[model samples]
Target: MAARRITQETFDAVVQENVDEFGLDPAEALAEAVEQFESQGVDLTNIVKAVQSGASEDAKDNQTHTVLQILESLRGHVGTANVDGMPADLKRFTEQCKLGFAQRYLAAQKDAYPTILACCRKVDGEKASLLAALDALSSLTDGQPDLLDAGGREFLMGILREHPDDPAVTVLAVRAVRHCCVKHEQNRQDLVKAGVLPLLTATVSRYSAQPELLCEACAALRVMTFDDDIRVPFGQAHDHAKMIVLENSGLKVLIEAAKAHPDNTSVLSELCGTLSRLAVRNEFCQDIVDLGGLTFMMSLLADSLDHQDLVKQVLSALRAMAGNDDVKDAIVSAGGAELIVMAMNRHIGNAHVCEHGCASLSVLALRKPNNCRVIADSGGLLVALQAMKAHPKALNVQKQACMVLRNLVSRTQELCPVILELGAEPLIRQALASHQDCGDLAQAALRDLGCEVELRELWTGKKGSLTQ
Candidate 1:
C-alpha cells in the first residue's frame, strides 16, 4: 500500500523540533518540511504548509476553538469528564452556533460538526442530550448543508424513529432535517426514500394540538417538497408533493391539524402554504375541498379578514385549489367570491394578497360564464381592475389581473363595457408595454374587452419569406 501523508500535528511537531533542536529558523523549517514531504510524494496540498512562532500560532488557533472547548466536556465519558454534562455542552455549542454564521463556519473548520454528531451518538437515548445535539446540528447546518453527510442524515431519521412521541426531540430533529434537505437535493431524495413523509404526517396527527410542533413539522414537510436546489437540472418536487398527498395522506392530516389551531395565524399560514404546495393535481384540488379544506379556508378568510399574512396564504391556497373546475363552482357557490373581494379590498396595498386574489378570480372565471356573472355581481371584476391599478409595477399582479379580465369578458361580453369604462385600457396597455411576458394575455384582454389592439402581421405573403 502507498504510504499515507503525515497529519498536520505531526508536521507541526517536526517543524518545532527543527527550530528548537536543529537551530533552523521557522521559515527555513517550514520549507525543509515541505521539501521533505514532496520528495516522498506526501501530497501536502491539504496541509496549511505554513509555519509561525509557537506563541503567535497558538494565539491564532485559539481564536477559533471556542466551539470545540465546550465539546471537550463530553469527549470522554469514562474519564474525569462527566457524561451528564453532555446536554449542556451540546446546548452551549448550539448557542455559540446561533451567535452567527461566522461561529458556525469556525466550528465547521475546526471539525466541530463530526464532534457534535459524535456527541449526539454518545448521548443517544437521553432526551435532553438528543435535543441539544439536534438543535446544535440544525444551527450548524443552517447555511452549511453539505456538512450533513449520509451518516448524519440517517442519524437524524433514526432519532426521529426512536422518539416518535417526544415533541421537543422531534421538533429539534425535524428542524435539523429541514436545514439539511433545504438546498441539498441529494439529502432530500435520500430522506424521502427513507420514509420521512409518513413520519412528518404522523407528527401532525399525533401532535395536532401542538402549534409549535405542527409548524416545525409542517415546515419540514414543505422543505421536502421544494425544488430549490439549483444544482440539479430538475427536482422531484411534484413527485414528492404527490407522495405526501397520495402515498402518505399528508393533505388530510394537515387539514385535520389546521382545525386544532384556528386562532394561531402562524400555524394556519404555514398549513395553507403547505396545502398549496400539495395541490399538484385536479383530484388533489378536489380532495382539499372534500377534506373540508375549502370550508376551513373560507371560514379562516371570513374570520381573519384583518390578518394580512393569513389572508395572503388563504387566498393563495384558494387559488391553488381553484385549479379544479368543479372547485371553481364550489368557491363561487359558497360565497367565496364575496369574501375574496372583501379580503383584497381590505389589503389592497399588500401586493401579494392582491396578486393571489386576482389570480384566484381569474381561475374561478375560467370557462364558467355563471362564475363570471357572480364575480361581476359581487364586484370581483372591479376589485381585479383596482388591483391592477394598485400594483402596476408587480408583473405577476399585472399578468394575473389581465388574465382575470380576459376570462371575465370571455363569455360575459356585456360586462366588457363596464371594465372599459373603469379605465382598464391604459393599465392593460401599460402592462403590455412594461412587462414583456404579458404580450398575449394583455392584448387578448384588451381585444376581448372590445378595444383596438396592435396586431403584428407575421406573414407578408411574399416570395422567399422566412415566416414560411
Candidate 2:
C-alpha cells in the first residue's frame, strides 16, 4: 500500500481539527502538527514559506482578525522546536515576515486614524466593530506613541463621549488612553488637554457597576494626574491640573467608584493614588475632607490591612489630605491617628508605608496642637521614633519621621519631653548628619527639643555664641 503524501492542506486540516475539536491553543496545536509531519520525514520548508507569505497579506488587510491570525502564526512557528536550525532562508523569512507584519500593521493604524475617528463618532450598529478596532489599535499603540497621535487621542475621547453607557467600549477607550500615557508625559498632557479627565471620571461614574471599567478609568486618571513637575511650593497651591480635576468633580467620581467596587483592590488602590495626587494642594485637601476622603481612607486602611499596596496608597492619600487643619482633625476624630500608627506597626519593613505614615502624622501635627496631642497620645510618636531607628538608611522615612518629631515638639510643648523620653534625639541628630536635605528640619526639631546650643555648636563646629 502507498503511504499518503503530506501536503499543506493536510497540515492545515490537522491544525484546524485540533483547534476546533480539542480546543487546543492554535500555536500549540500547530507545533504538535509540525512535529508529527517532521516525524513522518515531511520537510516543512515549503509550509514555512507559505505561512510567511500569507502573514504578509494578512498584515496588509489591517483587520483585527487578520492581525490576530498573523500573531498566532508567528507564535506557532516560534513555539515549534528545531526551527532555529532550519535553513537560513526559512530563518530569515520568519524574521522578515514578523518585522514586515509589525510595520505594515502599525502603518495601517497610523493611516487609519481618520477612519477610526469616524467610527468612534458613529453611535449606531457599528459599535462592536468600532470597539474591536479600537482594541486592536490600542494593542498597536501600546508602547508606540507615534501611533497614538493627537487625532487618535481625540478619537478615544469621542468613544467615551458617544458611548458613555457602553462599559465595554468605555473600558477599551480608557485603556487605550492609559497605554498612551503610561510612560509618555506628552501623551498625558495631551489627554489632559483633550479633557479626558472629565470623560474618565464620567466613565467611572457611569460604569460604577463594572469593576473592570472603574479600574481602567481610575488607572488612566492616575497616570494623567501624575505630575511631579507642578508641585505646591512654599504653602501655595501650584497644580493647575489638579485644580482642573477638582472642577470636573473628579474626586466625587473616584469616591463613588471606590464605593461601587469596595472589594476591587486594583480599583481601590488607583482611586487612593489619584486622590493622593489631587490632595497635594491645600485647596483640594479640604475638598477631599468635605467629600469624606479621610473617613473613606481610614476604612480602606482598616479593611485592607493585608494588602500592602492598598494600605500604602491609603497612607499616601492620608498624608496629602492631612495637610489641612480640618482634615487633620477629621482624621483624628475618625481614629486616623491610630490607623496611621497601626499601619506603621503592620508594615514595619515597608519603607513606603512607614514614610507616608510618618509624613501624614507630621502633617497632622503641624499647627494643630490638638492633633499633635492626639498623635502622641495614640502612640504615633513612638511609632515614628521606631520607624526612624528601624529604617535608618531610608532617607525618606527618616526625613518624614524627623518632621513628625519636629511638628509634635514645636507646637505641643507637652509632647516635647515625651519625644525626648522616647530617645528621639539621637535619631534626629543621626538624620541630621546622614541626610543633608533633612538637616534644617531635623535641627529645627532638635532646637524645639531644647538642644539648640548643642545643635548650633555641632552644625557650625564653633561654640562662640550661645545667644544669637
Candidate 3:
C-alpha cells in the first residue's frame, strides 16, 4: 500500500499527542512529528514556515528547542543526499538553521554547562542517553573549553570511573577528556588530580583489542603528556611529566596497543608521539629500546613510506633514543641510519625531518668513529649539506648539520678536504653569523678542517691574525 499523505492537521495531532501523553517538550514533539511526516512523503514547507513564524506561545518559550527541531529536520532532508544537487531553498534553509543553532548554543553554554553536568550525573542505566549527552558535550566544548568547569571535569571523570567496563561510554568519556585537556593546563592538572593517567593506562591495557577505545585512550594520553605546564624543571625530575606516564606503565600499554593493531596508522601515530615525548629522558630511552620500540620505529619508517607524519614521528623518537651509544649502535644495526638519510633526501625541504635526521646522525657519530665513516660513505654528508643550503633559516637543522660535520671530520680526517671542497666554509660562516646557538659548533667544525689560518682571516677579515 502507498504511504498515507500527512497533512497539516495530521502533523499537529501527532505533535499534540506526544506533548500531552508522553510529556515531550513542545519542540521535541514537533521534531518527532516532522520526522513522521517526512516518512509519509508530506511537504515540509508548511511545517518549516509554521516553526519559523514563532507564532505559538510554546515556540516562543522554547526558541532553542524550536531551532534544534528545525536543524534536525534540515539534517534529515540532507542526510545521504547529494548536497551539490540540493534545492537552493532547502540548502539555504539548512545553512541558516545551522548558523542560528550554533550562535544560540554558544550563547547558552554558560547556563547549559551545569545542566549538562547534572544530566551526566543522573545517567545510571540510560547508556544511550549518556552517550548522546557526552557526544553533544564533546561537540559543544570543542575550542570552547572554558565551558567545562571544575565540576564539569569532575563529571567527565566520574563517567570514566563509573562506567569502567562499558567500552562505548569509556570511549566517549575519554574523548571528552582529550578535548577538554588539550592546551588547557588547568584542566590537565584537574585530570592529574583525579588520577586520570592511571585510569587511562588501565583502559588502554584492558581494551587493547578494542581499536576504537585504544585510539581514544592513546589520544587522551598523548594530549595529557604534551602539556607544557605539566613538565617539571629539567634537573628537578628530568621529564617529570613523562616520568609520571612511565610510572603509570603508559608506555607498556601504548606499545601493546600498537602491536595489537599494526595496521592502524592513527594508533601507531599517537603511540609513536607519546613514545617520542617519553624518550626525551635517558631512563625512558633505554626503556623504549628494551620494549622493542627501536625496531617498531624502524619498521614504521621502512614499511610505511607513504605516511610522512608517522615517519617524522619515528625519526623524532629515534633522535631522542640515539642519545645513548648503545641505542645509537642499535639503530645502525637495525638499518635506521639508512632510513634517516633516505627520509632526509626524500623530504629535503622538510625542516623537521632534516633537523631530526641530522640530530640523529650527530648522536650516532659521537664516540663511534666507524658510524661516522658509514654515514659519509652513504652520502649522508651530502644530504646534510643540501639540507643546510635548502633551509638556511632552520637553526636546529643548521646546528645539527654542523655538529654532524664536526664529529665526522674530527673522527675521519680524510673527509675534511671533501667537505671543504663542497663549499662548506661559506655555509659554516653563514650558519655562524646567522644562528648564535650554532656558532660554537660550526666554528669547531671549521677548526677541524685544519683551516685555522683561514678561520682567523674569515673572523678578522685580515691576515697575520693566526696564533700558529
Candidate 4:
C-alpha cells in the first residue's frame, strides 16, 4: 500500500504492513500504533485482537516481546480512548502489557524516563487522553512502584515541575506523590521539599472550579500532612498547617457543590464535614468567615432540616466557624445568630441538632466580652436557657447549656445577672444538682457564676440540694 493517508485505519494498516514485511522493531511498531490510535481512534478491543493475532505465532522467546509491544501501544493510548469499552477479558492482556514493557523499559533504561515522560507530556496538553492516561498510570502503579527508575521518575516530575499550574497534571502528581508516600515516608518529604504544598494550596485556591479535582487534591494533602514525617513540613510550610482545608477554593467548591446538588445529601454532607474540620482551625476560621462561609453554611443547616445528620454536620461547621471573636462577629453580621436560633428552636426535638447547636452557641458566647453581648442580644442566651429545661433528658444538650452559661456568666457579668433573672440559675443548678455525672461541666458553670452576687447565693442554695 502506497503511503497510507494519515488516518486511523491507514496508520494501523501501515504499521501492520511494516511489522509483517520488514520485521520492524517492536518499539517502532508500537510507536506507529500509538500514532494510528491517536489519529484513527482505535478501540482497545481492536488492539487486543491485533496483538493476539501477532502473538499467536511468536516463538516462546519472542512472545513476551510481542505482548510488551501490545502494552506499549495501550500505554500510548492511555488518555485517548475510554477503556470502559475495552472487554474485561482483556484485563489480563492489558496488565501483561504494562508489566512486560514497563519492566523491560525500566531495566534497559536504568532510570531513563524520557520515553515515559514524553508519553505523560503528551497527556499533559491533550484533553482527550488526560484522564485516560492518568487512569492507566494509576492502574499501572497499583502494586508496582519499581516500574520506573530514577531517570523516569525525574522526567515525570519535570513534566509536573514545568506545568505546575495545569490542574490535570497537578492533580495527577498530587495523587501519585501521595500514593508513593503511603509506602515511603521519604516520598512525602520529597514532595514537600519539592514544593508540593504550594502547588496543592494553589490548586485549592484557584481550581475550586473543578470539584472532583478539588476533593482529590484536598484528600491527598490531608493524607500527606497526617504522616509524621511530613506533617511538620506541611505545617511549617503554611503557618503551622493551620489553613490546610479552609482556603477560598475549598469553601467555594463545598458551598457550590451543596447548591448544585441539593438532592445529593451524601455529597453535601461530605462538604459540610470537610468544612467542619477546616472551621475548627483558628487560622482558617477567620478565612471561612471572610469568605462569607457562615451564611452559606447556615443556609445548609436550614435546608437540611429533614436530614438530621446533615443538619448536625452543618451545625458543627457553623459552630467551628463561630469559635472565635472575629468569626462570631462574622456570623452575627451575616445574621447567623438569628438563623442559628431559628434552627435551634425548630429542631429542638432533633437530639443531634440540639446537642451541636447548644454546644456551638456556648463556644460563641465565650469568645470575648464584646461578642457575648451580641450573642445574648440575639435571644441566644434565653433560647439556650430554655432548651436546657426543655431537653433536660438530653445529657449532651444539658451539658452544652451549662457550658454556654459558664461562658456567658464569665464574659458578661451583667448578662450573668440576666441569666439569673431569667430563672437561668434554677435551670443550670437543676442540671448541676441532678446530674452528678456532669459534675465537671456543672462545676465549671457554677464557678463562673459564683461571683455574680445574686447567682452565688443561688448556687449555694442548690449546693445542699445537689446531694439530694
Q: Rank the candidate models, highest lDDT first.
A: 1, 3, 2, 4
Q: For residues 7-49, could you state the per-residue lDDT of candidate 3 as single tens digits?
A: 4445566777887799987788888887877786765542432
Candidate closest to the true structure, highest lDDT:
1
Query: Model 2 — TM-score against the truth?
Result: 0.67
Q: How would you encode candidate 1's per-residue C-alpha lDDT over 1-468 as one tens digit per residue?
A: 775667656777777778778999888998988888788888564355556332355574442145556655555542444577777777888887887775676577777788778877877867677677788889999888889887898898898898988889889888898899889998899999998989989998998898898998999999988999899999999999999998889999999999988899999999999999999899999999999999989999999999999999998888889999999999999999999999999999989999999988999999999999999899887898899888888999999999999999999899988888888899999999999999999999999998899878777878776665
| lDDT at residue 228 of model 1 (Cα atoms) | 90
Model 3 alpha-carbon drift over 4 Å, by segment: 1-112, 122-124, 144-147, 227-246, 393-396, 410-414, 431-468
For all candidates in order, the CA lDDT equals: 0.86, 0.70, 0.72, 0.60
Query: Candidate 4, overall lDDT?
Result: 0.60
Ranking the candidates on TM-score from highest down gives 1, 3, 2, 4
Candidate 3 lands at a TM-score of 0.68
TM-score of each: 0.81, 0.67, 0.68, 0.48
Considering lDDT, which of the candidate structures 1 and 3 is the better prediction for this target? 1
**RMSD value for candidate 4:** 16.9
lDDT string, candidate 2, 1-468, tens digits? 544455445667777667668887768777878888778877664343122133343353332233334444433433454333222322232233344444334334335334333333442245555555566556545555555776677677777787787777778878888877765666766677677767877777787777788778777777665543233223212343464465678777777777877788887887898788777667788877777766777788898888889989898888878777777888888998998898889888889889988988988889988888888889898899889888988999998998888888786777777788889888898988888888778888888888753444434557665564
Deviation (Å) of 58 in candidate 3: 19
Where's the lowest-lDDT run of ten residues in candidate 2?
228-237
> Looking at candidate 4, what is the lDDT of residue 47?
35
Q: Model 4: how far is 155 from its true place, Å? A: 9.7
